[model samples]
Target: MYDNEYFVVDLGNCTTTGEIINNLSLALETLNHTGKSIVLKLNDNYLNQSQLLSIQSLITSYGCSLDTIETTNPETIAIVENMNIFVQKPIEKRVADKYDTQEEINSFQPFSMPKAEEKKDIIALKDVNNLHFEADLDALKRQQESIDISSDLKEAGINPKEDFHTIDYQVSSQYTRPQEVLNEADNFSKSDTAVFVQQNMSKAATMELEKEFENAEKNSIGVYKKAYDENNFQEDSWEEVDFYETATTSPVISDSKSTTYVNQTLRSGQILESEGNVVIIGDCHPGSEIRAIGDITVWGVLSGIAHAGMSGNTNAKIRALKMNAVQLRIGSCYSRRPDGTNIPYILRSSIFTPEEARVVDGEIMLFKINQN
Candidate 1:
């Protein structure tokens, strides 16, 4: 069988060196022998050093090495031994030993021409301990089912024991203490003592008063009134504005440019620029940069600098599964991560809250996309 890592070439039927050379050359030319080690089974064929050297060179030219040679001929064995190649008995001999009759041996085909359909015969190692464990468990289950505990208990009940015996027991009187101990107990009861009660209700009442005082302080500082006025004006407004709505319309009008897809991760110092929209399937590491004229999207983490709308389209947005970029740019506006918000790296997680960033009122603003 031709294993995935090794190939076998059987040339036992070829009687002459020229026939062997032709068969081997044809086999190598017809099949894919790249990066595979070749096992040559010569059987009774005899070849000298120069012929063997030519075969080795031919195998080498096809990017394959001659790993082992199987032959019963002494001359062929000697040639292979001198060339430092491993030698083994022909596979036919091994098969003959297994099967007694020549007809049976001829009928048995252990190997064939390397083809896609022959992959089913390729040997593979597997662990069978799980199978044995399951069998043992099944045997134990059968053993447990064979026993009938209820029936055995009933049989024991039917045959009662007659060795039982009963004995009478006397009750003892209560023990009494000495007269000096009684007098000490009476004196201890007559002593004066102080009692303390927990004031949990008072603490709760104090907390309520503190909360009221805080409300009063806020009212005196006029902060509550200012917030109330703001809310009241918003409620009375003719047109209600959504919190996520931009104050000004986006500058980008069309998205007719072709999109660019990047499948590999962009490491530090790497830069990717596209005239149209850009989509990255992997992470953009620190110090890397991505510039797109339309929009930018990252399926993975974006930790580098991302400039969307590089051609000054404010409507172009930068979206990422994890948005922790050092700097985000949209159109002519750019914003760095806020102070104290810098992190060396973000831990990978299956859960993600994808976010999108775009220029809003001359400032970059980010919004979380609802997965629902």
Candidate 2:
């Protein structure tokens, strides 16, 4: 909880340094911590000197000062002593002490169960009936007597005074015979030869439908090519549209190029560059940049700028589970998200369409790696 004067960050639930930093950063970003003092609460969670300094720096960045630290870890206390920050017992310990004091005070007080007279009064209240409820019941009886039951029965085609056994029930003649019996009789009347012919006709019809489906699948490739040609036409010939024609020399694809793997989320203002290839195991947020000489592959969403084939290796490509990059560059070619495209700053979705972007001829083209 935070107030105008102080903001308390409870890192006691976090078990790792990364979790602590991530939680602290999120709290700073989402809360109004400006010009206030901060109190960090930790429970038996160790923090080294560098980690404490980073936390201090992070607090200062939000225009807040680290005033006090409530921690149960001795290591954390030692680190805070040199940092000139006040230390105190954790909130959990303080709350436990308060409860203990209250219990001790309660022990000396006089208390007893309810007396017999008070118990009798409580039991008598449960047996008390409401006079208004009895009046409502009498009113309901008067209303029920006013309703004309004979008229309702006559309207429903029943004589109110007639015995139930004496009443006549007229049934439709068509439904006199049970439907199942009629069906069984009809099936028995059909000849065996006729039944065989009917089954053969149904089998032939099913086979014909299966053949049609097979034919449709075989011609799917031609249909896709026709649709592609109709929508991807340019004013100039496809061969003449060389956007990156200046790069005439091709760089050799080294067999031993090292690959770098990053396992943390790349926040804004973070830049990751690799000489060969770069693989990110997490999301690349907006305002971050990634440059690789060989290839770039993101296991998560790529919502930032990414440049592959920085040294003119046009063969290099960029791939991601969700391809929503702000700008994409491959070799000498540069491309950006189309104008008026609605790209969210942060994408959280259960469904992901893996896509790959590569230089096709002289233009960057995206291709779906899997069909839904």
Candidate 3:
């Protein structure tokens, strides 16, 4: 049995290129050579996920049974897909030209800017086959004459009102009720049915006739001349329907290496360093800081500070004896209190304990990491 003495191994300020140590398993083997189970005392606070996984893997590889792998604040990185949709109003249906000076019209007068393929609006209608003209035959001729009018008025180069002879026909078609046809089978269901004397005819033949009658009575979208909600009408032919879930998938962390803290403040101008877990023993002076890519714990007073989880580890935490730090964070998130107002308590006080920083409304909360 060993005496009541603790052997401290200060992991010298080492430069870790990426998330995982180059030879993590070998590093763990060296730690286990002491014949002591791995008790990672993170001198530098600020533990990121990649380093956490690396350290855990190292200890396990060395078969150094975790005597007490104390990790505070199980950092949680979350990417909630918020669906705030921008709804666009459907296009409106413009008024169609259908009214005639005398004759009835059916459809809209679709305008086109004389495509090379199609014939121009210039009509040979006047010289066409013999036909009976409408009652207002003079007006009909005048309307046709309007399309062939001089290019000046057509291009808005000159207003027709300035011309004496121009009648200025502002004629437009008015919508009319469609001609309704009465069906002979309107009351076919209530009408008398004659019994068939033919023996060769099967019951199946008789049933088919009845089924057709039932279908005609049932209402449908096609049965109506217009859509149910014409004001908000959208042509089904132009619209499409398909699954959009694939386009709205969650993000995947491609490389864990990119998940380490980049911007960091080292203790003094000496450049603070870390391997995995970093612990702060005293209150850090303003402008004087410490940064690491692992867990951060302050056993003493913590003052001027820019605490953060520069890496993308949402599970990383900031725990202190007093947590009124100026800045706090885990991963890309930044948790901070106002200047002068945040008085971080870092003493071995009754209220302060070694715990992981938890989240209370997205902001970091300093509390016992495992009181739960």
Candidate 4:
């Protein structure tokens, strides 16, 4: 514990001011006696940014590297558009070096939506405010409950239970680059320390390492995908299916299911086919075709081609009173009877039937339209 003087210490009962002072004193004393130091730690989980930086300033006495720790939580949206780089920069250092003017950095994004609660992320790097209560989770919950739930939050699909608190976590300073440490390995052997860190690791180096690791992982995944894609083209256990030209979706031996066909004038050059009973109320115009695997009917004039029972069922029949239709069918076989009939032109309808048409005594016959 003495060697790990710069540990990420968790004061479990630091909610009281007295407890905060006691733990802070103990931690500082431990580090001072051991010839080690604690500089910075960051926690972004359960405390606001202002609260975190304030606590850091309250404890820090000697100005040191890794001394200032800042934190943030996952907000639903960013305050300013793509301002992450701003957060990484030092608070007091050159703003004019980065932006054209101080106004540019200070001025809020006017086009952006107003924040429901302004997050003041001010930190105290200079003096200490006698550490009042360190943290009160119950007080935090009560504060959260006091805020009225926004209608916009409801539209954003967040329930009342969802809340975020930004807190600070501490980290050690003796940062080093592995390459620099390797170069001084002989010197390290001369020294008594277990690990020899030659040079301080920069922030840019940490960012670069993170980026390279992501790239390597992504490339490995791409190589695996390419290998699978090359082999996936030729699938094993492939099967081929054969379908009829018109009845592509129907089975080889199909029966008519319960179905209905509505007001479509099956005009010339058009054909209607179904797997179930077909009903047509309009004219089946001449040269047009109507075929049903089960049964077919025409309420209006059937002055054209009509075929019933398409699936080789001779028991199915076609009956029309006008009988001027050029083609008819029961099952697989078609009937192409000419206009030369026993009845005259005007009486052709009477000769056939008034209404119902069906296959009777092995041939198509007609009865009244409503008789069936």
Cα displacement (angstroms), candidate 3, residue 13, comes to 55
- How accurate locally, in lDDT, is each candidate? 0.61, 0.62, 0.36, 0.41
Structural RMSD, model 3: 39.7
What TM-score would candidate 1 get against the native?
Answer: 0.32
Candidate 4 vs. truth: CA RMSD? 42.1
Q: Write the per-residue lDDT of candidate 1 for residues 78-177, one digit (tens) a residue.
A: 5676687766656545654776653453344333222334433222211333243345446756875797565565567742222111112111223232
Off by over 4 Å in 2: 1-256, 345-347, 370-372
Global lDDT of model 3: 0.36
Error of 2 at 138 (Å): 70
TM-score of each: 0.32, 0.32, 0.25, 0.27
**Which lDDT tens digits does candidate 4 get at residues 1-372?**
233233233343355545644675676556543333332222233444444444545554533212212223222012211222112112222632554553443231211211223312112311232122122324544775798667667788875343321112112223233565555544554232222212111221243445455545321100000011122223521333223543555544434453344455666666665555666644566667765556666654576666665545556645443445665555533344422322333332222223444554344444444333
Writing each residue's lDDT as its tens digit, candidate 3 over 219-282 gives 1111000112222223642345334853686764332122222222233333233334455444
TM-score quality measure for candidate 4: 0.27
CA lDDT, candidate 1, residue 166? 14
lDDT string, candidate 2, 1-372, tens digits: 232255667788999999999999898899765877777878889998999999999999988888778786755765676676766655445543553442342232111222334433433433343233345446755885798688788889998666222122221222132334333433533333233223433343344445455556321100000111212334334656555873785765655256776766787777787666787767788878887767889877788889887656677888887777878887766676643343443223333557788776555767654211
Range of the 10 consecutive residues with the lowest summed lDDT in candidate 4: 219-228
Q: Candidate 3 versus the native: TM-score?
A: 0.25
Among all windows of ten consecutive residues in candidate 3, which has the lowest summed lDDT?
78-87
